[model samples]
Every structure is written in C-alpha cells, then in structure tokens.
Target: MSSSASDVAPRRPLLAGRGLLWEAVILAVGVGLFFLFPYDLGFLSRILIMIVFVLSLDLVLGYAGVATLGQAAMYGTGAYAAGLIAIHVTASPLLGLAAGAVAGAGIAFVSGLVLMRAHGLTLLMLSIAVAQVLQEVANKARPLTGGADGLRGIRMDPILGLWEFDFIGRAGYWYVLTVLILVLLFLKVVVNSPLGLSARGIQESPERMRAIGTPVYWRLVWIYTIAGGIAGVAGALAAQVTALVSLEVFNFDHSAEALIMLVLGGAGRLYGAVVGVAIFMLVEHVAAAVDPFNWLFLIGALVLAVVFFVPAGLLGLPKALTGLVRR
Candidate 1:
C-alpha cells in the first residue's frame, strides 16, 4: 500500500467510532427530551422532522454547492402524496412514507435536469419558479389537494400495526425520532461514500472535477434527488403526526427558515443540521413567547450575529475560538 493509504487505514476505526459516539449522543439527547418535555411532544416531533429536512438541504447546498430555494416543493409533494395515499389507498404510515420519498425524488430528478444547467441568479430564480408553479397548481387543484383549505381526511394507521399513535402523541414521538436517527445514520454513510466525496470535489471545483472525468451534473442530480427523498420523509412525518396536509406545506417560509437554520448550525457538518434546528426552534419558541409580535427582530438579529461574528457557524465556533486563542 502507498504510505498515505497505509497511514489512513489505521485511522478508519477511530473515525467510525467517533461517528458512533456522535450518534449515541443524539439518541441520548432525544430520549431525554422525550421524557422532559412530555407535554410538548408534538413540538419536539416538529423539530425532528425539520432536522431531517435541513439535513437534506445540507447535502445539496453545503456539500454539493447547489443553491436552491425550491426544496419545499419536494417536501410538499411528498406530504400531499402521503396524505392522498392514506385517504384513498391505505392508512399505513410506512407505505405513506414510501410514497412521499418517491414523489420527492421524482420531482427532484425531473426538475434537477433543467435547474442544474443554470448558475448564479438564474439557478435561484429557476428553482423558485419551480416551487411557485407547484404551489399554484396545488392551490388550483381544489378537489384533489383541497386548494386553500389544505388536504384533510388523512388517517394514518398505527406504525407497523403494533404501536398505536394515541391522543398524547407518545407513539408518534417515538416514531419520528426513530426515523430521524435512521435518516441521520443513512446520511452519515452516504456522506462518507464515493458519491459524496465526488460531490464535494464538484462543489470545490466543478470544472476541475469534469476535467478529471467526473460527471458533475449527474452527481448533482443524484445528490439533489437523495436530498429531496429525505425532505419528503420529513414532509410525510409532518402530515402523519398532524393528521393534516395543507398548501402551507409548500410555503416559502418553510424553505427559508430551514436554510437559515442550516446556515446557523454550520452547513457542511451533519451534526450542524441537528444543532441548528434545535437552537433555532428553541430560540424562536422563547422569543415568540416573550415578544409575540416582534420575534422576527430577534431571529434576524441572531442570524446577523452569527453571520458576522461566527461565519463558520455555531458548530465551528469551538475551532474558531481555538484559533483565536492560539493566535
């Protein structure tokens, strides 16, 4: 083996164990929150769902260097698809999640073909346009999507026909948490795989990557599709837990807020997504409760502070501090 390869092989075990350590921390924190905030199980579930959504965005925007604002389009598509499945086809949650994933991936793969061709402002505009068109269609399809009122009549069966989703949401909380952990683990695997490394290379320099024989566009498309599928899972979770699917699922704020959280937590790191969601949601909750009408001011301030003072994001703060201390 080459000296570099030989040196790297021994560290693989350490890295893998580190990954497991982080995941264990997440699991412990999730369980603690579950018991501590039993009254806010529903809210906690929302945070978990959004964590999944932001993680998807991290894969595309942070790792793949894809600038986008239409992610909610895939998210809403999955939600509506899942809702329709539950009402017309079956009440099975598992099947509904699958439908959501497929719907999100389908939209992402189709739209990514065109969106990937554009760059800078044009790409952003095109992405926004795609989402706008979908939102309009959902609004107009009154009979199918319930238009402005939202998709109602969704009834999710117990998870695996065993754990009943009861009134207080104990079963639902556990279900969403399990999904979040699985998604996190899956993403950890993907981000460390060849495809993910190729994506990073493309992000660093698409021209260089292409010159080296990487199919840059195709790599992006695959990454975007994967992200969309994960976002769709988040959407499906939202629909199942709330027992309602609405046009608001396609709301621009959802995408914007998710992006903001991702940025705040630090985009490139997987744990950043989780931390960002938790901190953003927690602060927003407290701020809104305290200010009610002017909570946006606090949120804006927080984002600005992070951007100016901690460009590497909250997760990178430790490194930043260490650098300063050493300096």
Candidate 2:
C-alpha cells in the first residue's frame, strides 16, 4: 500500500528456452490454422480478440494480485476510440487501432492512479464503478457515439492498402491473429522481465515484498495500467470486426465474459487465455446455434464440469490426456 511497494518490479517467468520453444510452436500452429481454415474465419477472429482480452485479465488478476470486474471499461475505451477515429479522423483501420490503443492506455493510466489504491472487494467495486461510469458516458454521448443506437458509419480502408476486411472475414481473421501474436509476444517479454518477477513476488506475499523494500502498490498500479492497455487493444479488435461501437462495449457482461474466459482457461498460465477463449467461443457458437434461448445453462454446466474435472482449464486437458496415455 506504501509508495515503496510500487517501486518493486514484477517477477519474470522461470523457464526461458523451453518456454520460448513451446510458444513458438503454438504460435506457428495458430498461424497455420488461421491460413488453412476454410469455413470459419469470423469465428477464429473473434476467438483471437477474446484471447487478448483474457490475457489482459490474467496480467491483473492472475499475475499482479489484483481482482477486478471492470476490465470492460478499458475495452470500451479502446472500442470507442477506434470507432471515433474511423468516423472522424481517418478510414484507415490501422490508424483507428493505434488511436484506440492510445486512448485505452491513457484511460488506464489515469484510472490506475485511483483504482490501484484499493485491494480486495474495494478494488472489485472500483473496477465495476469505472465500467459503469463508462457505460453511462457512452449512453449519454448520443451525438458522438450515436447513443444506444450505436456508432455505425465506419468504413475502413484496406489493411496496409492491401487486404480489405471482407464479409468473409478472411483478412480480419489474419489481422486479429497477427495482433494476438504480437500481444502475446509482448506479454511474454514483460512477464519474463524484472518487473514481472516483482509482480509475482507481490502476488505471493505483498507484505513480504514490502518488507523486503519492494514497492508493492506501485507495481500493482503499473501492471494494472499495462493490462488496461492490452484490454483496450482487445476492444479495438472487436470494434474493427463489428464495425460499430455501442453501450454494450462497456457492459457488465463484457467484463464478466472476460473473467470467465480467464478463469476457464486457467490462471497464471499465458496459453490458458487462448485456450479459454477458444473453448468458450466454440461452445457459445455451437450451443447458441442449437438453442439460442438457453445456451447459458449449457455453458454454466460445462463451466461446472471444468471446475470439477479440469480445474487447470482446457489447455491442461491435453497434458491430462497425455498422462492418462502414459499410465
């Protein structure tokens, strides 16, 4: 809680070479699937966007010992920024994306000054409050955001003047995939850096970290800001794909979904973010197609099953299967 706590950096990942190899392999597989898939680029693109959101959550809730339910605040900030940029500044989606990131990060930094001060339920409450305020702002900004009707009129230029976002979503899929890859790489570097190690130390024992001359509070604030920036990127991705920004961008459900995806995938493990998003999106797609009115019940049941059977998440399912085979 002291200023000194914020001075300490986060802890880095323990594994170096083997971890990099695994990450490279996974990235290659993900890229290959994006290119090779024939029927469902939209679905995959959505998954990748959600993966970024989930990873951002992991950074705060899993790595930095902050519990928040208002991540959608940043996500919405990014989405609105992208939409605003597209509509007002330029039609270039990449420019809109950059604008969104800047807006998201700026909001995070400002919000972090206050939100990062509290812990436990207070932290959660502040987060929720932040999102609610953003939602209210979006609802009231009918002129700029089009209010509840949503901001529509965004026409993006071809990505890099080459690939256009199509109805088929092929280019969009690749774009999201590329961003996800870059975000993951950035997160890897961050979690392996000195700052990340301090985060881990704080997570394990904030009191101890503070006692040992670590700046626990500021470290948490810094991590929260970073995560918020990432969440904003996720929002920008969603805005790009949907081509609109609305009050729903700051909705409670958006934040809750990000949390569910993070928990479903597994906390602390980076790949768990992707795995959680993939499974969550796939289940939603299949289940909603089958029963639109009651898909949530099925999802709840599946989440319960995961809690009981594969607590580590869908990512751990493969390792569990391998263990069974070995046995």
Candidate 3:
C-alpha cells in the first residue's frame, strides 16, 4: 500500500527545525558583523550586496544545475533598469527595486527560451554572448546610459520617506540586511517546495525526469527567471545605495567573481553563498591592500588551495578536517 500524504507531512517538522537553526545562525552572524565592523560598514554593505548576488547565482547554478557564466546579464540589466527608473520615473527606492527585478526576470524569460535548450560549451558560450551583447548595447546607447562616463543623477528618496541614507551607511546596511534576510527566507521555502524537488530531479537526471513526464525545460526557465529577479534585487540595492550606476556593472568580472564565491562557499547549500562572499571579499580586500601589484596571485593561490584540499568548498571544511583527523 502507498503511504498517504499525511504520513509524509510529519517529517517536514524535523526539516523545518533544522531550517530554524540555520536561520538563527544567520541572524547571529549578521548581528555580530554589525558590531564587529562598525568602522567599515560601507565595505561591509558592499559584501552584503554581493552576498545577495551570489545567493541568486547559487539558486541557478547550484540548485537548478544551470551552468551559466552570464548571470551578470541579469544583474546589469537590473542595475540599469533601476537607475533609469530612479532618474526618469520615480525617486522611490522601493519602486526602483521592483522595476529592476521585473526587468531581470523579463530578460531572463526571453533569453531562457533559447538558452535553456543548449548544453555544455555551447550553453556557456551563448550565455557569455548574451552578456557581451547587452554590454555593447549599453555602450552604444551613450545618451541614455551615459556611455563610458557611467549613469549618474540617480537620486533616491529617503527609504519609505523616513530613514535617510547617511554618510556612515548605517541605514543602507540595515536596509540591505533586512532584504537579504527576507530573500533568504523566501528561498528556503522555495528550495524545499515540490518545484524545487523537481528541479533537483532534473539536475540529477534530466532524461529520467523527462521519462517520468516532467517538463524539464520549463522548470529550468522558471528557476532561471526567479534567479534573475533575485540578482536584479542585488543590482537595485547597489544602485540605490551608491546613487550611481556604471557600465562596470555589466562587466564579466562580476559574473566570474560571483561564480567563484559560490564555489568557494560550497554550491548547493544556501549558506555557502553567504560564507563564500564573506571570505572572498575579505581576502580580496586584504590581499589587494597588502600586495596591490600582484593581488591576483594571492587570490589564485587561495582558490587553488580550496580546489585541491576542500573540494566541497569552505562549508565542507569541517567534514573534510574531520575525515583527515580520522585518517
């Protein structure tokens, strides 16, 4: 006899308990960082924003198993969309953020029509091409995008017309932290949902999933759209806080760095995104300060060490170490 749905429902409480534990850990870490880096809140805020970006990428490449290097396409599109909205339409930060997310999702949905069909090297190249095309279009629209000089005159109203964005960045930090927490919570629900399980199934074996009557292609496109929206939120946050948007937002480096951070923290685990961003950004900041002439070498060495030693990424370090000790 097959088990009823009610029989399996009881197991969710245990999973929810674990989710609560992780949420508490995240809250503790965020609170600790607020106190630990009072003097460098601006830099810390940037890390928080990147954490959002990396988290979005984790959703696509890690959970959805969509091998992509053009996530910056969605990111940059959101940035530009938010910046333009702020400049031309409304001074409302929230509205700009919404616009950014919509733009990202819309673009992703359109692109995924073609992108989700390809695989391997072809998929990677096509993703890269999309970003390049967007970059070129932004470049050519000199009047609209401000060309190489970057998008300026982006003024945002005080958040909710109450808390003013101050020089110390306390408001921005708290604002971003709140948004990050909310997004993380939403994603926790998503990754545990039936759709998320289907995504995992597709990732593990697309052929098998298809044979089981699953719509693998549409599932990917949906996840990709959702991921793009999340990435757009990150870009919107950057634009709102910085009060400027630049062409560099579309740069390939952003996409590459995000992927590295995801891998470093351990893809497939949501917390890995946060941990990876924190570690990578901290390392990059210190290394660049200490050896501005050749900081890349230090970064490269660190990545290599992680790859060779902690194949599961930094989140797996504890297990890796435990195994070594056992040996």
Top lDDT prediction, candidate number: 1
Error of 3 at 129 (Å): 1.0
Model 1 residue 41 CA deviation (Å) reads 0.5
- Model 3 over residues 272-306: C-alpha lDDT tens digits? 99999999999899999999899888878878888
- Candidate with top TM-score is 1
Give, for candidate 2, the lowest lDDT window spanning 10 residues.
9-18
Query: Which tens-of-lDDT digit does each residue in 1-327 have in candidate 1?
Result: 777777543435313865588889999999999899999999999999999999999999888988898889899999998999999999999999999999999999999999988888998888888888999999999999899999998888889999988878899999999999999999998889888898889889999999999888888888999999998998999999999998888888888898999999998889999999999999999999999999999889988998998887899889988998999
Ranking of candidates on TM-score, top first = 1, 3, 2
RMSD of each: 1.8, 5.8, 2.0
Off by over 4 Å in 1: 1-15
lDDT of 2: 0.85
lDDT of each: 0.90, 0.85, 0.88
Higher-TM-score candidate of 2 and 3: 3
lDDT of 2 by residue, 1-327 (tens): 998779875764555666677568767877787668757887777788889988999998778867789999999999999988888889887888887778888888888899888888898899899999988988898898999999898878889999998998888887887888889888988887888888888889999999999877777778888888898899998898878788888988888888888778887778888778878888899999999999999889878887888887877788888988999
TM-scores for all predictions: 0.96, 0.88, 0.95
Q: Which stretches of candidate 3 lie over 4 Å from their true place?
A: 2-18
